[model samples]
Target: MIIEEIYQSYLNFLKEFTAFKSISTDPAFATDIANTARWLQDQLAANGFKTEFITGYDNPLVVGSYIVDPKLKTILIYGHYDVQPPYAKASEGQARMIEEDLWKAEGWENDPFVLTEKNGRLVARGAVDNKGQIALHLTTVFELIKQKKLNYNIKFLIEGNEETGSPNLRHFIEDHADLLSCDSVLISDGEIASGHPVIEVGFRGVINTAITLTTSDRDLHSGLYGGSVPNAARELMKLIEKLYQGTTTIAIDDFYDDVIAPTKEELKNHASFPFSIEHHHRVTGTKKLFSENSLDFYTQTGLRPSIEITGFESGYNGVGFKNAVPHTASAKLNIRIVPNQDPKKTVKQFEAFVKNNTPSYATVTLQLGQGCKPIRINPKSELATKAAKLLTQEFNKKVLYKYCAATIPIVIDFKEILGVSQVLLPFGNEDCNMHGANENFEIDLIKKDIGVAWGLLS
Candidate 1:
């Protein structure tokens, strides 16, 4: 009945919340980010939360606290306000040359910044990724406070730079340790595996970087200088080809030497999870599985490391042929690391590998971003057990312990800086299409998240 009562109001709130293009990666949306932060603060304050803006950073962080009593246990909720760019930008030596509209190219039926409902689904940029989840929690808190049923001290740290890897997160956590200290932390950002409710026990870490190869100052005519000069694109392509040895293993030295394998019990639990190969194919649009030594999906993602090429820009790709040789070529890469692997050391190894493999005529440069360590939470912790029980009751099915392949940089910061137990309850559907065009969420899952939030906070 509570879910039914709050459906319309929650949908309205989500529509307003998702309209802001609070993209943290690009400075062109600074005003939009500020507006979003203010909107969050005002909403929390209206719902009886004492709110403050954590500033002096790249993007402001919104913290809201609702304390009933000092003796009560505190629950800190973390979510990001930032959404990835609606389109990808092609850059040439740090200068963005083209802003390609991926939304249109990907065949989005509605405006990405406008929340649209079609066939019982909400479509918008960040609808399910983070804004929708954050909106659901806030609406649940509003209802709980109205019904006078909240029992725990609730604190929300809604940040603005998660899409770009939270560069200022470490400093923020260190400076506000006392303010963020809590008995437990709750996060709802990722998707449920195969639409089944899951308690994510661990997640892989990640680092994003770009490698640029420069052979000359300007684009050269391929017809005049085809074999006389070095082609940056060709040289960079050869370098990238050496990044891996076989199909699954990275060729970089010691890349996979530091990963910790899952235990027997953990493997057993993964085998029992409700996984469907058909569902995996439906979501990924591929019929084959790329795993190491023919491992299962869980083992491949949760237990192993991966190197992915996210973006590449070189030469002329236009309506017509330019017949020019590109002077510079750049490739963006994302490396997923497992537990016990140090990010700094891994970056060094990656750098050395590139340098050794690169051609002598070309000059290579590496631009690195922030790195996050992997996290493994105890599945049997008191808070985790409680969450499992609540999730089972809500979804009317047994809860699964998931080893998430994706990374959330702030989760590890919460664990290390606040020293609190954490519970990750995923509420989005597997086909939510986060960080991509036509990103959407199901109305059913939105209601389910509100119900779960009520149970947790109460």
Candidate 2:
């Protein structure tokens, strides 16, 4: 295949796809997601593959399959069509117009939704995470098929709800196991911590919890009950504090009991990365590190378990201070667990801890939300070795292997139902500003990723 022609076609398709604002969070973009899925299905069909739409509760999954040889290894290429909402709010003055705030910035040099080539960078939303990556996979397969370069069967599982924790992906996977059965899965959705081409071997799981504590029926005058009543806000704070004893490790019982320590080789490979504790703090603009042992920060983030307090609410906030004790206090928390730690067991332990620690006067309520299990694949798997070798050959740099902190629910479900492992090969940078204002992707990286995909297929 002519590399130049393939790269140009890939870029054109990327721009056209990125123009559609398929924001999964907004109901307004429901049609847009469907349109994108239709376009993708058409593209896959045009490439000489059997295609079908796996309808779900919200958006559907676009699946396409091609069999080169029944005996050849089958690979599942998974990606998402949904994107996070843009930051172009009409209320933010001057930022409303696409040319003004949407475009022209140090990192963002053009409209995030409109593709622009500036300083050899492609500025657009989903350019890298992950419309561009998805396009790369598609173009790679298409070009190979066109040139008769492919030698194995390929299955595409493009989902539309990955951004929202893949609410329906588990059921989809279970229902379509025969259709999606494959030797392995390749996902281009995560990035290397070192900002280099790498294969993600593992991903952490998450358990979200909402806790509410009520001490009284309604707000009470602080002066009248200052000495007698137990403040709900104070009690809630105590409960939360007990979960984190001024240390990075969570204080919840048995939280780490099921955590599987990294292998000796995995730890050695992690140490090979040139990560400076001081430089990380400087880049984050923090005066001090969170972990007691500064060297443990990387482990805590990449391999260890953690509890995070996402939000908290209590009492009133106005011009003047209201002298009243809050009747109810609530907090939102997310606990990230490592491999071997079941999300259900972790949540149960957390609830039990809160119940045992709560005062008799205060009633505690625990609401469990979404939960998923952590996943880790062998670094020496045949597919992983092949991908790493191809990435090194294409990029002329050693491939970095790292664990992603975020959760991809479908990955776990795919493994459980289909018995497949996914390789996360992300083309996006760390500071892509996803789910934030002025999200942008480097144009040069987009082109390079196309080449990388081509090389991987080769």
Candidate 3:
């Protein structure tokens, strides 16, 4: 069987892939990112893929293709070669020291970056969130080629910008339409919703904005005009609090105008899923839960729209109290939008609401950030159904089909531009610490995930 061989090869590839600090945000890692791309290109070439590097303004995309039978279906596999920024500066040295101490206390058998086999887990960055997935797909194709088992065409588009919101992927896909044309696409960048096998069928869109409130031209001493002058900080807080007052529902007019209700079938499926509210609270370390309505907590987080205040900043944050009316105050907010809701339209409505409600003495400025449309895929596609059956057969577990609250903008672009349905089969755990400190992937999952991908292709 190709399973054992594929597992060993994945380990070898992961060790090398994780060693390169392909941090996308830092210009210092430019060469590292390019090197990672080249390495992936070489692997594709060796596996009989007609491969080339599509050079970007900053990073390069590794594109490869193979044709088996013109009549056979074509599947495009997508993954990223870039990794999130790592903490390596002197200011973070103390934190690293503390982390090392903690790792020791936890009795970690091997180094986090190195491919260490302890008990059963493979400890390393990129082991599960992407590099391992990429390696698995590549190795599966390689094994098929070696055994002459491939019966369909495959195209691989490994990018280096997914960690940075995939800003340039749309242009690259548009420019290379002919190369990426396929009947379907598969993405391995998501996770199992509740640590069980799952096939994510949809993802929520996102809209981020910064709200700034300005009052006086300069700071004013509270003693000089304590009761007369307006405070921008207090005004900003008032505007923000208007989002969720007394209840959890946002007070913005028409905020839920475009939200589509979940179907009866979807609601039934969610109710049958093996989700535990107590487990969720324990895992998140939350003391309480509150919402406008009394619904299943999982339904609210997975299917409902949410608005959050991510950060707030104002005047006079010092060692002691300044007691001043600040000139300006700002808060960063993000909204996870559901399907049928237009981010631009939502932003316009929010702006109008703020303008109409702002007090006469204060001014509110709304700045819109990146936004993406929600995407849903047919759960009954041949590829998805076949993969689901294979996963259940192999793992002896029921696979859950659900939509994720997080956003992946390119999924919509792929559907619109390439006319391809994408399937999300995440092998990582929910608490994999993706995009956070001490991020690590379980080694056992990495091994079994290779088997899962191979089984899907077979």
* Best model per TM-score: 1
Report the C-alpha lDDT of model 2 over 268-349, residue by residue, as the tens digit: 8877876666766654556767753543445567788888897788987544578999999999888898888888888788
- Quantify all predictions' global Cα lDDT against the true fold: 0.86, 0.78, 0.77
Candidate 2 similarity to native, TM-score: 0.83
Runs in model 1 deviating more than 4 A are 90-102
Residues 1-458, candidate 3, lDDT per residue (tens digit)? 56777777777878888777677867878998989999988888987889989886358998899988889899998988787654443232244466455444444444445655544655555666577677778888888878777766899988887766677788888888888999889888866756578888788888888899999799999899877888888889988887875655777888888888878888788777786767667656677776546755555666677889977888876455788888899998988888888888888877888888888888788888657877787878888888898778766788998787787777988988998777888777666666654456666666667777877775
The lDDT leader among the candidates is: 1
lDDT of 2: 0.78
- Candidate 1 TM-score to native: 0.96
Off by over 4 Å in 2: 1-4, 26-29, 69-71, 86-112, 116-120, 215-235, 278-287, 292-297, 313-329
Instruction: Give every collision pair in model 1.
Output: none
List ranges where model 3 is wrong by over 4 Å.
25-31, 56-58, 69-71, 86-125, 216-234, 290-292, 314-326, 357-365
lDDT of 3: 0.77
Task: State every prediction's TM-score relative to the real structure.
Answer: 0.96, 0.83, 0.84
